[model samples]
Target: MDSDMSMHASYAFKHTCWGILLLFLAGGVADCSVVVTVSGPHVAKVGSNVTLNVFITGATRPTIVWAMGDIPVVTWTLGSSSPPDILDPGGVLSIERDGSLSFHNVLLNYSATYTIRVVELGVGSNTSTFTLRVFERPSGDPMCSVTGVNGNQDLQYRCQWAGGTPEAQLSFPVLNATSSGSGDFNLTRKPSQDLNGKEVTCVASHPFLQRNCSVTARGPADFQPLVSSMVDADKKLVITIACASTSLPVATVTWSKGNQILTSGGRYQISSNTTLLFILDFHLNSTELGTYTCNAVNILGNQTNDVSVLGPTVSDLGLFPNQEGTMVTLTWETPRTSVITGFEVQMMGPSLLPSPGGRQRRKRATNEFGTIQEKPSSARSTNISGLDPKATYRFRVIPTAGATRGQPSKELRAGPGGGLSGPAIAGIAAGIPCGILLILIIIALIILCVVWRRKRRQTRYPVSRAVEKVVATQPNLNTPHTLLTGGLKTSAGPPDYSVHLASERSSTLPSVVSPPPVRMATTV
Candidate 1:
């Protein structure tokens, strides 16, 4: 046992002596300084190639090891015949002899803290670390939207770009504004006239991509005006008109007549915002009955609408055909007041054309007014005659007080068959030609029968064939008012003084006809 232990101790002392000798030799080389530097904390986009270069000084035959975080990736030794030993099984990482690291078709997972270690067998060793950040390039163009703010008095514009790493820088070039970090860029302000129809742009900038989006600013739109009339105290008529509009910037409202702009004055009241107008002492014969126009103007454009007031006329005039169809009874209702002296009935129908068969064909002629008939104010119904039973006719009633004629009533139709059913009239018309042909055939047959009978009877029976021809006939069927008023104020934007005549009565007053209120948008 003593001999075995002595042999073991001698072998260990030899190994220890060799270790100390190597250490003394290493210490001599350790005096040389080693320095290593990697290019940077680098940046690269996915699917691209990048290199993290390394610089070394005072190092010889160095062995380099590269790691990502705590995980080993690749190792290379200077002047080694063997290739680098890559820890990565995917083959995405590579190293050069100079201790540099390179990435091929980089991926997002490749982003990490990368360390390069340089070592020389007899010299000092050094390590350098850098961060590699992998980012995705911005995809597609930026998106934008607009919204109303401050009760629609201002507009807010927002722009954004998605699917980019580390956020993208966004800016409104026109406004010279920018947003921080990854948030969207927003701008809000009242729109100006000059901005109307102009394009607003947002640009997004990133390390790997650039994109932009835009929108057009708009002006005034959707303007409408309403007009109404009523009876006020002192038995005077009052008229009210209002206008409204929508615009990026609020629009201005103005009232006008033909070639004239109206302002607040005697008998005329306008709202401060220029949206409402009121007329006092309105009468049927007054000059305040012409067309009144309202205009809404904005920086972008303008829109206008018109309303007219007129005199009273008749209503609901109806026409009824008599049993024989030759006459039509006309009935209508009038306003409660005595504004109308009488009603004039106007008739229009086709003229009769002579036919060889003594039957008449009605020929329609343009502007063919047949006759005008008059009825007293107390009479609500009257009979119109001298109409062709087979022809159609149209009639209208005009309300008249002496020489002044108010607006006319709606037209009514009286028809092709005098009191005949539609099917009966159709059948009669379709059978006329067939009846004529049948008559000729029957006459010929009768003549032949007569001659044959005469031949058989000879002197005993002398037959006289006389055919009486009967033809079946078918029949055919068929303002300005002035108002009296007091003196009114006038301006350069003068309200029209021409009185307009209309047919309907107002809700509160009888015998008052005003222009029907209209809603429309007229672009200027």
Candidate 2:
């Protein structure tokens, strides 16, 4: 039995050796070979077309099959082509019996990692993996622009764009990333004045042959300097304009009449202190009248200010007391225009009130013509003869010359309707209250002095008065002590039996003969 078992083992071992050799030989040859794989993109967008390959060839063609996300695409075999058939239709995929796979109008849901396998009738199947990914194109309006950072410096923004089945390369102009595309960007740009308000654009590129996406940015318009002025009668007008603070941008300042531009040759005259953004002063003469517009401008913008210097502002208008009458003394020193010829001093009141509106041209006057006009010193004192002490009137000296004639000077006095006229208010109304206040002050001073003196005496000599009253009750100096004792007698009781007193003589009163006994009177 043991021998038989050994013999059986020997045969089994020999058979196994033969089987291994046969397997090795069979691997080298086959009836047919299968090769399955995906052509086209590994990651594809939805609604797309792709070719899936499943080739079976060695001997006779075998059946080939394909599937996407669990849905079968095709199942066929191309052998002698017994009968050809078209299985799946539009939006789906298909494959001929020959093992050629085609995907039609794909959807996002169709996207997946697909497995393609080919089988040679009796042989096993071979498969390959394919991954699909879907993405959309980008869209929007993008642009670039520039704004002022300082006087000479500007900032820029670049807008960029792109469209594709996936992220693609986006091109943008020289600009800050802040405006670059619709995605991640950073502000990075330095611009010059010439680049300010300039236009820029961006172009996007994608792999497929599609129209490129684009965007552009145009920026900050030109800025005009804001101009302003303060009119000064005794000095040149100080003109100030607002402008960019950095880079010291240059500016040209000018003067004009009304809205007409002024030139050095024209009647208009102007002077400036600064050629750039700054605070400056401009002088205007009496001749440069009407509407004085100070203009400031640069390459960026321009600004104008219209200052109405109507007339010669009168200073020091008064009446000098004179023996003949009141002398009208007036000074023409002020915001004088070259247009003023001189002045008219007219008197119209005193039952002869001429101009109630303070504008009576047909009144009496001492015509005064000015000399060395541009100089304030030339507008010194001018005397005019005028009478009427009890009458009240509004007085004014009008200026006329150059453009000064077109624009009248400000009113010197609006009359009593506006201000105090003549001596009526100055003498009766104002002076009376002042006089009353002075009298009351004097009376109060006298009363205060009396009260102060009385208080001082009480503080310095409080007991002296009481001692004098006691001394008055006694008579002679023969016994001054006795006399003092006599005053000690109480009105309600007899005198005390024992009493000691110290005698103190005042430096003012004599110690010799005394006066008769006299009681000091007291009252409540």
Candidate 3:
């Protein structure tokens, strides 16, 4: 037993000696004098490549060693036969005759605390360490992107990058854009297609990279899709599909209900190709209501719309006419589709075209519950009243489905009052009297002309010879005494003064009288 214990003790001592030797050797390896620094400057960009240059000017190349943190880097020993060099995929280390190291393609991985060691028997060996800091290359500038754009709008471009090897130039002309460093690049282009139907590409030039790279954006194709948002209206599911596609464009349309393979049913009706409208109506009263899935299959791609139906629409439409007013009442069953919680009532006149301004009547009905029309199968009926007399009205019932809430109905015509014949008709019958009055005026004018002609002829007639004889026998004149005073007037007897002075005034003119010497004695 004593021999065994002594042997054990000897073995333990030997192990201790070996451990001590290893510790001393490890410490000697750590003892060295070296210096390391990042090349160019203390700061570098995160993305742009940089080189790490280390200088050991005051020390010999044989005594110096370098490491990245705890990892041992290659060492160059001047006396060794092996080539004094190290190679890292990130960059190659060139050992300069002056004992400096040059590393190219410096990466973020190179960033960290680095230590350099050097030892030459004289002057205690020393280690110099440095920290490599990398800041994120300025969030690689903001880039602009456009998808599914159209001719109505133009493509816009702008760029902003930070932390590049050389600061980016924000003032350069877009037509002659130039980029610096490896970080971010952008382009502004007016992409126009060629007649041969090839995509146009825009190129960006890199000043630092010494090369040009191209980016291609898409433009117009043969088939285009314009899908209308979904809605639940009427008693079924409704969706509108309009295409601005450019080909002879005879497209086959197929609708699907979710993963459940769709089948053509009574409720689906497509408008004539000339009209370009399609409708699917599932007259969902209580029993026939259920959720529906719709898919529009086109050349470009397939669009899917899922809608749920809910109620038994109670629709009431009645017509009434009275002395004063005519009225119509419409009531409908609830809808059986998702998102159709209410209804929109539309009344049209001369068939009111949907507003050209893209407007709907904009009235709505609401449902308090989140109801999914799961196999609804009942009918529902509403009323409209106070319409003008004898007027004709057209009505249509359409179901709302999916996203938008309403659908229009087919047109219906209603005739109110159909009132009595017009009063102006009697006035039209009295026109004969006016014509008779006109004729009477014409006859009166003819009679007046005849009377005027007769009067003019009578005034132009001559008198008889008997009137002339009566005037001749009335008086005679030629006496001188008659020429003075009263005697001058034609008289049968002379004036007294004229009779006394007859002889003296014999030279005066004589007067004449009627009864000249005896018209009565003329019988002799």
Candidate 4:
């Protein structure tokens, strides 16, 4: 036991002797009076680089040592015979010959008290320490929200900034309020009368980011609608009205007549949110010409408009028949027309034609035929078909304009088969002259044929008959050649004798020697 205790005491004595010798050596080297100081920024952002420089004066050759919170991290010496002069344990530190230490890609763990020591070859070491602060930049700008409180008399606004190392600051100008709450800030203010329609603003600020947001205050207003009325072509009364309002909150529009509420369906058409159209179709009467009202309501107040109705007017009226006489088309014209619903046609006809049946049946048929017909206003004309061909009928037209009917037109009559139509009469007129000319031509041809046949017989058989006749007249006058040579008859005298002989032969022959043939007849 004594021997072990003496061994431990000798080991402690040797360590103390070595420590004192090192201290004396350090004092002697520091007696050269070399001074070292460090200068640089104390704050740095994460992901940024920083340099802490150890500045030494009055030293020709110096060594640098870097430590973090009393833990040695690296050391550097100049012109050392050793293989490695720089001792960086974690490879996060580097040093320059000027005793400047640099940290790359600094992190939160790097935020600490850092000490830099500088030693001259024959002088003692000098040390300096500085606190390093590392912070992260804000990821985004501040967000702001505004809401109306206390019935819009006051407004509350908040600004928020998140995802940053340090808290953000918020401010409200309109509200004159500011408060911070864990990266969020809020403010509320009761506005004065002068602040009406003013803008509310909130601004936030941080070391790395700054942002602002704003909103405006507006109030509601009142408006009235404009209304008008007219009669449509379909004889329906149309009411048109529109209203508009400029308000923060939208206004509602409605249509009404007297105490009756009108909506968008059937006869009432809501053309737009602000416009309406009312059509009077079924209960069409003069009463439809009345005043209409439009109401536009908002938070501010309500307004109304009244428009009186403009009734329809009547114009030119006429009637005519269709091309086919079986159907009669009644036509009439409307001038300055507006919203004419339709036309109505009324007809009265003579009693029905006598039938093979009894008188009671005919009377019933006549009653049916006299019934009136009506057509829509769009159909400018009314066609009445299936009428008795020989029967006569009277037609009258009435124009309806917006629940009002115009004066009836004058009556017109028509008969389909009572007499020849215009076309038939015109054809007869044209054919009469041609028929007379044709009959005269036929008589003339017949006369020409008879005369020609007589001339043909005279030329073919009369010479022999003349000789035979002379022989019969004078027993020895046998031949026409003897008569010709004897100069008994000249050409004129012989033609006269031939005619006289022809007249004796047939009583139809004419005298005056027939004046020699004007045109000779050819035998075929």
What TM value does model 4 have? 0.36
For residues 1-524, write the lDDT of model 1, one tens digit per residue.
99988876675455445434433444334333888888954788888888899898888777777778865567667669888666664568888767688888988889899876666775777777899999987667788766566765677778888777867888777865444335477787676766776678887888877777887666656655555555555656576777766553445778888888888998889988677898777555666667788877754567777766445478679889887777889999864432455678887776533544666565674455554688775678888775667777778888765456788788777876436546668999999999999999999999999999988874442322221111123233222223435456667875554432222222345467754544444333
**Tens-digit lDDT string for candidate 4 (91-205):** 5677766768788888767788987666665556666788888777666776665555565445556677777766666677556644445477766655444444566666766
Cα lDDT of model 3 by residue, 1-524, tens digit: 99987876675455445434333344555333433333444554455544445554344533555566755454555455566534243554455554455545456566667665555544445556666655444333333333222442333233344454344434224334353223343433443333112222223222232222222234323443332323345534554334333311122444444444444445444445421223355333553344444444322234444445443232434333345546555545433332242344555543222344756453232212222222212223344454444455544444443323344433344675333324444665677788889999999999999998888766343444555567777556554554356544466876677665886677665566654332221222
Q: Pick the candidate with the highest lDDT.
A: 1
Q: How many residue pairs clash in each candidate?
A: 20, 18, 90, 11
State each model's CA lDDT, in order. Answer: 0.70, 0.46, 0.44, 0.61
Clash count (model 1, backbone only): 20
Candidate 2, poorest ten consecutive residues by summed lDDT:
368-377
Question: Candidate 1 vs candidate 2: which has greater TM-score?
Answer: 1
Better of 3 and 4 by lDDT: 4
Candidate 2 segments exceeding 4 Å error: 1-32, 41-48, 59-61, 69-90, 108-111, 131-136, 139-164, 171-186, 194-203, 209-524
Sort all candidates by lDDT, best to worst.
1, 4, 2, 3
TM-score per prediction, in order, is 0.36, 0.30, 0.26, 0.36
